[model samples]
Target: MAATHDVTNQVPDLVGHDVAHDPALLESLHRHGAGWAEAELRELGVHAGSAKAQERGRLANENPPNLHTHDRVGHRIDEVEFHPSWHELMEVAVSRGLHAAPWRDERPGAHLARASKLHVWGQVEAGHTCPISMTYAAVPALRHSPELAATYESLLASTRYDPGLGVPAGKSGLIAGMSMTEKQGGSDVRANTTEATPTDSGGHVLVGHKWFTSAPMSDMFLTLAQAPGGLSCFLVPRVLPDGNRNPIRLQRLKNKLGNRSNASAEIEYDGALGWLVGDEGRGVRTIIEMVNNTRLDCVIGAASGMRAGAVRAVHHARHRAAFGSALVDQPLMRNVLADLVVESDAATTIAMRLAAAADRVDDPQEQALRRLGLAVTKYWVCKRGPAHAAEAVECLGGNGYVEDSGMPRVYREAPLLGIWEGSGNVAALDVLRAMAKQPDSVEALFTEIAPVEGADSRLDRAVSEVKKELADFTDAEYRARRVVERMALVLQGAGLVRHGHEAVADAFCASRLEGDGGLAFGTLPVGTDTESIIERARARF
Candidate 1:
């Protein structure tokens, strides 16, 4: 999170999915991906000739563009900035961190190294660090990179970094916002004490130290500050200009619990320059869009952790030995293995569905649902999924804890989700708030997925009973834990379906056809496997 340190390596491009093609995806995002249930943003009047807008547009494409290359070398400086005449660059970094490969890669060094650096150094970053903050930077670039749609998401995990930083083209253009918890905030946002004051220099100055800034050393920051009107956000930059030259200060980084790769920081601004995001007191809502991204990302990151862990467990289980038998051969172990498979699939499905929904969610109300779904998913997976890894560890006995085994690493990264972002309590409140705002629509959402989660079946009859309990409850607060638990199961099931292995929805439908095997295809009216499995299970019963 410092400035003036030497950076020698070029970040690696993300390793999966080609994001530059597929116009068909945008159409789908509007339907199921973004989910249009939320109210719409009334488009503001278009000013074709507004000089300020024109200047912004013109500069947005100017040379040296808006990439914050200094962050690469900003890891060692510790000076205060006081100049007031710096020019704003019309550019931002376009890299997506958690969703991108090399960073999200879960390998030995790259991801761990980057995340740890951010953890320890993020405080003085002078930029954004968390997944949610990164999405702020991606929005502008997406304006010009329409072709990057289908491929530009880390929404499942956390918009913790800029998408322009993801893959294919992640070298430049990054911007960040600091929406870490306020003092009255969860994960400690409530403890925030940053203030924005009108200065004699005519530019505002921000003075505060926040606990969690997702990315700390980028060029620009969208920061939250307290004022007479209440909480407001400001566009703060890391620059000090004396007359015509600009200089910046890199402050401090946080030592985080898990995502040792993405840098989360605690920052202090001593009269750093800032511009209000909207009107006075309007700063809080202006950046909710950023938090919404984080909510969805929490789901994605957790799900990704589940998948990575499952894959490793699956691989290890196949080769491991137990009591002179292959570990996978034991019936009890198979159940554990199946549990791993099922949960991983469920987690992935939830993230992908929400990711698709996020792409099209223009309405705040509707986005609230997507947000709740994602938070619940992330919270549950990040919280419970690690136990599955531990189960695999038990399957491996002591070897699982060995850092070299890959199991320990996944275990390490998985738990961080619950602590970072909003954490479970924060996410639960977020979902509760969403449910409270649109009780009926929220109920409808619950009803819509209940059958999917608990299909008319022999196995899920109990799950159906739980859904009924959710439906009968009128108070979101009353049903908070119950609702979250059920929704976790719902998303857990959905996550299973989005699997690279095949979906869980089909698997549930397949259960109707083939009870215990967990099939991938829907039941056919003609029923071949359905009929046979019915007979086989009937014989057992």
Candidate 2:
């Protein structure tokens, strides 16, 4: 080969490393009482980091899902065809119990363990996790109707990844999707105009168009419609009990910016039969349970992306040289890489803590903490995802912008998490709503942070500022974003101070809480431990 064509300066492809060997992830897993799951987590990590799994993720996204509105004979078959890699990813996720398995398990930290697994495995592919999260979230809402829960809960929790459209009874396992958003009402679901008229058989026929229905190929979906009593929640099956396709018609698949591996479609429910999940007029109340669970996954998804981006950036810096030295050894580059790692570590810490709260369902204080904490954390972490991914991509310079580097996919996927559950405004306002209605939740949040009080003066000041912000609701709506951002920082800081690595906690407190740094990623304070932070974020083979 000519000297000009040589690849001497090229960085090695990052593979064969354990994606789950992350220090922050491991610490959170053990701290949350899920130490028993470490072995399996590592196994999944190894698989996630393997070249085969990475290629699968790439192929799934590159191929994307194609919507078949009609068959060869022109039969109205609203089916979505996906690449085999998509199914493979889905199978691994299901077998790992990253879906509804926690609801079935009686273990102490089942939810936490599941969350940790999701965080680890999600690095392989994020689009498939959309359906997995819906399936997991669907169980909580289905429990509103004991009959429906009895029939499908076990199957949803089953590790078997049974695909295709079939009756719930005939299927060995089930996957679920959610159809809520309409063109008229995005976040304001109460404005939904979909009508659900009652039939004598105790079921309702739905007639409406869903603007955004993700995972359209799933066997069933939990939807909302206007019923006799008022707006209500209902379960709509793709194939009814008689083994015939329902009236769900896929209009077209959305040409989205990212998450192309999963098919999101605009569908028409032409007399689709649906069974009521909860009491009439209680649609929002029932579906919110499912929303809350998926929201937790949103945080997990963002954290997963952050960790992936950070690792890739660090890997590139360590191998590639610049200015007659390795990029990792450069001062400014170290600050940038270390800052990325700190942000990722903080996000992972809080996500695991929220999962821990999810496990303690019976504890009033924990539930209260979750009520308030989840909203603020979701708002801030997801909002930071796009910027973080952008910076991580920048760390790779031109290599990151190219498709082959895999950083572009991370950048594309980051914004979806923030937009999926709720947009930034909606999430921030929810924090205020929880504080207004559930005042005890505020106390629970403070109590959760109390253990780490005085550990870091910056964190202490931030907590005090949060209290001041909460004390006045006069302009709460206007200052919702500002208030929620500070609350999120304080929560993350507290978690780090309580359990995170010393260097991480110090960097986070100094830059994020104390405002000692500039707005960009490479602006950590002078004394920040860049070396230790970058080492923690490096991918381990």
Candidate 3:
């Protein structure tokens, strides 16, 4: 043989694995009362994480949505065309009730179950989750007015996914989008200049520009505009009842860093016929419900990305050899992989627990927890995603940086979650606002974590510090990030201690609560059981 090369140490394929049946995911689901749906979840997971699904994800990203502004005859026809793979993914998502399953079922663990499904599918392709999340979140806000709810609830709740554009009454199933940001008012809707002039038919006509309108293919959008009464929420349909295009015109699609499979656009409304959904001038109050649900999905999407990263990193390390040993067997690599595992688990734990609280809508305590817990979890988990993806990419070394490896795509997708629903500062300020306005939220969070009070001394100290920090409201907005991070840490500590493995919990409390960690991933204390933690996280795959 002239020159023999060895390929024996190459990592085995990670595709075709059942994401929902993964031990870590299963553990989290069971802990959060969603285990009852394990059988169905496992089937979905197998397909979602399968090699075929991977190919679909790749093709979808490789070919982004194309905007069509006019017809062949020069007629104004605003439409977006996506690759077939995008439609395939949407079909799977909608047929499974991944969009509005909780609202449709109204069972004990409906929201938790829907959250689990979203987590599983998101790992396969996160871009499609945007429209799914929007449709899911729109249900509650649509209910703000019985008339609006009665018109769209059943269509939204339907498992059918129809991508066609026409009159809403002609469609069997529907998707919803949102446009709240304007050129001047980024997040402050009060600064919006979109004029909502009352029409003779008791409807409103919107005339203004929306800087960001995601999922332009949606049949309707929940948008904010300045009504004569003040800032108000409106249901702006893409097509009028006459089956003609509404005055909503697509300006252009955004050139985003990621989420290419979904179309995010800039549009203008010139006399776009709309109906008020809630009390005029109460736009923020009405749309806040939708924003909250989407925020929870952000947490889920971030955690799902973390889980995917951890799985790929650990799986690669387990089989790939270097310097006469598998990478996973090396002490330094083990520490890094284990730390990623802890981060993923903590994120998953908090997201699932919040979902469970959302499911328990009948309970007052759970309601309070949902109010505060959403902001806290969304801020910490989403903020940590980009960092986590970076570390996971490093674990695969040069191979991870390539687009074909899928790591770069995930890395790009990470920041969108932080930006969407709400940015980090926005979430942090929301947490503070919740505390100042609804003190009961804080007490509910305390009650939620009280079960693990003495489970770990470090956790106890962390809890005490957070309570002390909350006592002084001076410059609270400036200190909001620190306060929210601490709340997230304590919540994770308690959750891990109660539901996660002791080794994992101890590592989290030691590194996060006790301040033993550095400013990066893989900074867990040397004495931590790195091997056991990595093995547990990897065993799921």
TM-score to true structure, per model: 0.61, 0.99, 0.98
Q: Which of 1 and 3 is ahead in TM-score?
A: 3
- Where in model 2 is the C-alpha error above 4 Å? none
List residue ranges in candidate 3 displaced over 4 A: 1-8, 539-541
Candidate 3 residue pairs in clash (backbone atoms < 3 Å):
none
Instruction: Rank by lDDT, highest first.
Output: 2, 3, 1
Q: Give the TM-score comparing model 1 with the true structure, all chains together.
A: 0.61
The RMSD (Cα, Å) of candidate 1 is 15.2
Question: What is the C-alpha lDDT profile of model 2 across 1-541, one tens digit per residue?
Answer: 5577656889999999999999988998888899888998999999999999999999999999988888899888888899999999999999999998898998888999999999999998899999999999999999999999999999999999999978987899999999999999999999999999999999999999999999999989999999989999999999999998899999999999999899999999999999999999999999999999999999999999999999999999999999899999999999999999999999999999999999999999999999999999999999999999999999999999999999999999999999988999999999989998999999999998999987888999999988988888888899999999999999999999999999999999888887556889988899888999999988888
Quantify all predictions' global Cα lDDT against the true fold.
0.44, 0.94, 0.90
Score candidate 3 by lDDT.
0.90
Off by over 4 Å in 1: 1-76, 79-133, 136-172, 177-179, 182-191, 199-203, 240-252, 362-368, 450-455, 458-479, 491-541
Clashes of each: 74, 0, 0
Q: Let me know the TM-score candidate 3 reaches against the reference structure.
A: 0.98
- Give the alpha carbon lDDT tens digit for every residue of 1-541 in model 1: 7788785322221112111111112122233423231111000001111233223322322211122324456653433221111112111111223223222334323222222122211211112234333543334323232332233323322323222212222313334445446445555443456777877765576777665565454445566787667777666555433331122233444454444444455556766676666556766566665565555544555554554454445455556666777655655655555555545555544555555554434555445556566656656766665665566566555666765454565565656667655666767766666655656546545543554444435225534555576567577666666567666664444333333233334443344323355322222223222222111111000
Best by the TM-score measure: 2
TM-score of 2: 0.99
* Local lDDT at 398 for model 3: 91
